[model samples]
Target: MGGYGDVQMIDENGLRMDGRKPGDVRPITIETGVVPVADGSCRMVWGTNEAIVAVYGPMEAHPRKIQRQDRAVIDVAYNMAPFSTTDRIRPGFNRRSREISKVTKDALESVVLLELYPRSKIRVSIEIISAEAGTRCVGLTAASVALADAGIPMTDMVVSVASGKVNDVVVCDLNKEEDNYGEADLPMGVLPNTGELVFLQMDGDLSPEEFKQAWDYNVDAAMQVHKLMVEALKGGANS
Candidate 1:
C-alpha cells in the first residue's frame, strides 16, 4: 500500500474515486481473431488494461524431451511491451513475467483437454500492450478465448477477476491507483459453468471476513465477464 495515510479513495457516499460501487467492475471489451497469422487470437480491453493473446499448435512438440506420451503440453509466455507502462519496461524475459507465465500456463492447462492431443504442444502467447493493473487476469482470460477460437477442445472457459481492499473497503476489479494503494489483492480464475477454480493468488493483508468478500466479489465478477466471453465467441466464426 502506498501512502494511504491521507489519501481518500472512497467518498462519504461509499462510491469509489472512479464513481463506481464497491463491487462494480470496470468496462470490458473483447474481440477475436485480432491476429490473422496465428491459429487463433483475441484482444481484450478491461478498464485501462489491454491484452492480446495468440494460440498456435497442438502441432508436434519439438524435441522429444518436451513431448508427453499421454497428453499435450501447454506452453505459455506472458510479456509486457516496452511501452506498456509509464516507464519503458526493458525488453526480454524478466522474473515477474516468468512467474506470471508459469501460473497462467498452469491455469489454462487445467481447462484445456490436453489428453485429446497426444505428443503435441499448444502455445499460448499473451502480450500486454497497455496496463492499468490486473494484466495477468486479462491475459489469462483472453488466452482462454483465443484457444476456443482455435477450435481447441476444452471442458470449460476460464474467467479471471480480482478484488482488493482500498480504504478499508473491499472493491472489485481494481484500477491502477487502487492497486498501488490497496491493502490486499486476491485474483481468481473461475470456471463459469461449474464455479470451480483453476487459478488463485493473493497478496498483502486482509481479515478472514475481508478475504471472503474479495473472493465473493471475484466470483460474481467472473460470471458477468463470462457472459461477454460467450457472446464474443458466438458472434462469428472468427471469434
Candidate 2:
C-alpha cells in the first residue's frame, strides 16, 4: 500500500480523485495502423497511459530451436520509453519488462490460431510512450488490436483491465495515484466473447469479498473495452 497514511482518495460523495465513481473507468481511445511499416499496429490511450503496439511476421522462426512444429510462436517485447515516466528508465530489457512481455505473450497465444502457421513466429512489440499506471494492461490490449489489424486468425480478442482497492473501496481502474497508494490491485485479461481469462495478476491485501468485487469490476470493464476495440478495427477497415 506504500504507506498511504491518512490519504483521502475518495470524497464524501463517493467520487474519486479524478471525479470518477467507484465502477467508472478512465477515458479510453484506440486507433489502428499507427505503424505503417508493421504488418499490424495500434495505439491505445487509457487515461494518461498510451501504448503503441506493432505486429510483424508469421515469418520463419529464428534460431530454429524456438520454432514449433505444430503451431507458430508468439514473441512479445514490452518496453517503456525513456521519457514515458517521470524518472527516465535505462535503455535495455529489465526484469519488469521481461515479465510483462512473457505474460503478454501468454495472453495472446491463448487466442491466436497459431496452428495455421507452423514453424513460424509472430512478433509483437509494445512501446509505452506515456504512462500513468497499468501500462501492462494497456500494452496487452493494444497488442490484441494490432494482431487483428494484421489479419491474424484468432479465436477472440483479449481485453485487459485492472481494478484495485483504494481507501477500502473497490474501484474499476487505478490511475497513477490510486496505483501508488491503493491497498490492492487485480489485473486480468479477458476474452469478452467467451468470458474466459487469459491473464491474471494481483498484489496487496484484499478480503474475499473485496477480491470478488475487484474481479467483477475487471470483467465488466473488459467487456466495455472490447467494444471499443471492435469499433476501432471496423473503422480501420473502412478507412
In candidate 2, what are the lDDT values of residues 141-230, reduced to their tens digit? 999999999999999999999999999999998999999998888999999999999999999899999999999999999999988899
Local accuracy by lDDT, each model: 0.93, 0.94
Clashes of 2: 0
* Candidate 1 segments exceeding 4 Å error: 1-3, 236-239
Model 2: lowest-lDDT 10 consecutive positions: 230-239
* Regions more than 4 Å wrong, model 2: 236-239
**On a 0 to 1 TM-score scale, where does candidate 1 land against the true structure?**
0.97
Which candidate achieves the best lDDT against the true structure? 2
For residues 60-168, write the lDDT of model 1, one tens digit per residue.
9988898999999999999999999999999986999999999999999999999999999999999999999999999999999999999999999999998999988
Task: Report how far off residue 106 is in candidate 2 (Å).
Answer: 0.7
